[model samples]
Target: MKSEPVAGVRPEVKRRAEQGSQQLQGEVQKLELENLLRTKFPFDAIEPVPKGEFGGDVLHRVVGAGGQSGGTILWEFNRTKNWSDAWLAKLRDDQRTAKAEIAVIVSQSLPKDVETFEMVEGVWVTHPRAALPVAMIFRLSLLEVALARQSTEGQQTKTEMVYQYLTGPRFRQRVEAIVEAFSTMQEDLDKERKAIMKQWAKREEQIERVMGATVGMYGDLQGIAGKPLQEIEGLSLQALDAPVVNNRSAAE
Candidate 1:
């Protein structure tokens, strides 16, 4: 016979197991949402708050080009329960602690009125499927506002430069002129390379001509030396043969 589970032990174990599973799911959701936000807004600063922190799950700070913080967005993740007013209140309190300009909840279960995202008591509620777009909208808005404030605070020169480079005809004309100069320089380099190659060919022809003339002169000298040597040998032989009779006749 199979033994039955203990009276309170089984229920407690089941409750703990369920609680652990929910916690795991919630953590996973938080990580996924954080990764999505980070990828979508790489220029912004993303910070994941520690567990039991006074603020929300993630904090996004709008960072300017100069590495200054502008606006903050507090993000919360809820997977176990449906969207409720209590969560909104909690987000509001967390926002104050986080010093955030916007508060959002990325939940698995959205409220009845919210198909994707809607403002519920000033807190933005978004489902997981629409998290990226919703977060992007908030991040871009905050960035625009931050940049505007920065521009008013004597940081307009760089912004003006970017604008002019993007839209000014003079900047385009300067770029075109630089490109044309580079093209002309490349063409001149090609022409110089061709001229050098031609010079090398002419030098090679002159070298070949000189080598041919040297070889011909050497052959002519060899021929002239051979003829004189042959003539000397012939005279020596003829004198050897007739010399004995001549000497005797002279003496007589």
Candidate 2:
């Protein structure tokens, strides 16, 4: 039987892949155009054309114009062969940009490869070797732009921690069930704990009142002038010496 395409892949997935491929092609074509333009001799001159004839005329013109010769120009152009399709394709596919960047450092060829990296907060962090050919370097810059655009999708589908734990079919129903159970048990536990704490607090107040009366009686016996006050000085020190009793202290 003939093989068929796998099912369940949404049409949008295919569309996105196609769109990415198209973009890659357009980028590659732009690189090629830049490389070709760079090769044209009059790229910086008044007229955008080869300056002189190829053979003898070029030689005589160069010799007559100045000290430099046609051979020197040819040699310079040959050196620029670094800006080739093969090199650009290498850069496009290479995942280990670090190695390539290292090679760029040793070569010290193109100024375009000297890149200024910025922080996430938009601060200039570092400027690394921008040593690759201009066309390839510019094309690689596009990858950073593509990465920024791709990151937005992650933000678009951003989920809270609770959502991650409780997602999928029947999610809301299961979550509600769990929440209802927790709520019911939690309320009873909280009520019992609060009641226990309230009882302790009542006992604590009674003890304080009794201690206040005792202090007053002692002051009266000691013949002090004013009503004696129950000044609880650093009872927290006593509590600290005692064993920890739950998050709320028994004395507290």
Top model by lDDT, which number? 1
Model 1 lDDT per residue over 1-252, tens place: 999977999889999999999999899889988888788777888999867878588888887666767688888988966456678767776776676778889888887878889988768998889988887788778778767766677656887768855674335434544675699899999999999999999999998898667656655775788755333332343653664566668899
Off by over 4 Å in 2: 1-173, 224-252
Those runs of model 1 whose alpha carbons end farther than 4 Å from true positions after fitting are 7-12, 51-53, 65-68, 154-252
Cα lDDT over the full model 1: 0.77
Q: What TM-score do all the candidates reach, one by one?
A: 0.55, 0.21
Tens digits of lDDT, candidate 2, 1-252: 997866767687888898788667645543443344345332221111234322110110112122322211110111221323333222222212211111111121223443443221111122213212432333334344345545564555446534643663235434544675689899999999999999999999999898777766655654654446443443434643676567666557
lDDT of each: 0.77, 0.37
Poorest 10 consecutive residues of model 1 by lDDT?
228-237
Residue 125 in candidate 1 has what lDDT? 90
lDDT of 2 at 141: 46
